[model samples]
Target: MRRLPLLLLPLALAACNGGTGTPVTIDVKSDDGDNGSFRMENGTVSIKGDGFQGNFRVPQIKMKADDVDLDGVKLYPKSEIAGFHITGGDKPGNGKDGGKDGSKGGGKDDGKVRIDFTSPASLAAVQNWFRDGFTKKGFTFASRGDGFAGTTSDGGTFTLDLSADGGQKVKGRMEMTGS
Candidate 1:
């Protein structure tokens, strides 16, 4: 019974595009000769065939920054959220850190959530903001190839990467996985 929600998380996260209250049918066919249809309507998804059948309400993600929570993770000031999504742990492998050598060695937690945003602040400023905030929250930070990684006292993990988006805007992504 517990696995049901975990299994549904991928489907919900994949199909969610902000419901429009209109019904739509999607036929899915794979090279393995397995096929099925997914019907989405009014914030609900129904599946048929392929041995995966059920109806689940797609979880709504809040676009407002104040309503978003990534444990104690904080978004950069004046950031405008562009996208958000989550993946359950049961899906296998680790977070994006799963290596190219097929080694699953990072973020062994219950789930992972990511938020994409842009801010009209300098890249250095954004990095400093997160560094200060995470440090104050008892997270130890380490530099990564692309950005930085932090681990909380409770074993949760988070990563932040920011790059200039031309002019004064900076684009970034924050991913958290654990507890």
Candidate 2:
């Protein structure tokens, strides 16, 4: 009898997890270590820090459960919105400014990343999202595929790239000339 019940346990446990689990929204929070916070809920992410606060949302398309913490970039600070989020930069890193000659120093390069995520929005829609957002914020741009190549309000040269099929998930990146 004991052996019978033990063998049955595996079947029962597998039954409980047989199919794709229900979709759920997830909330993640991080500390700025100075009274700021970074929060990511489902497809959107946000961040806030000493002198800056930003809210971003990407398309919420179908995807298997996975984490996009972006190697713990520590940019998302504080806020809430739906749709898209892009946050990742640096406070300090292996790229330090003053180290031994061969030792790693602060990178002279401004940080950047390629953001590829599924969006219910099409390639055109995703492109429009950035274009509208940027223009409203006083960033003038020359339009491209699904994003913009232009300049920020403060005159920073800006570039955004979007890659996808007609109505597919978007693979994109946003960059400024410098920091």
Highest lDDT against the true fold, candidate: 1
TM-score of each: 0.57, 0.36
The root-mean-square deviation over C-alpha atoms between each candidate and the true structure, in angstroms, is: 8.7, 16.6
Worst 10 residues of 2 by lDDT: 72-81
Q: For model 2, how does the per-residue alpha-carbon lDDT over 73-117 read when each residue is reduced to its tens digit?
A: 111222111223323333333345533345554554343433333
TM-score of 1: 0.57
**What lDDT does each candidate get?**
0.62, 0.42
Work out how many backbone clashes candidate 2 has.
21
Cα-based lDDT at residue 157, candidate 1: 81
**Span of ten consecutive residues with least summed lDDT in model 1:** 86-95
Clashing pairs in 1: none
Q: List candidate 2 segments past 4 Å from native.
A: 1-118, 166-168
Candidate 2 global CA lDDT score: 0.42
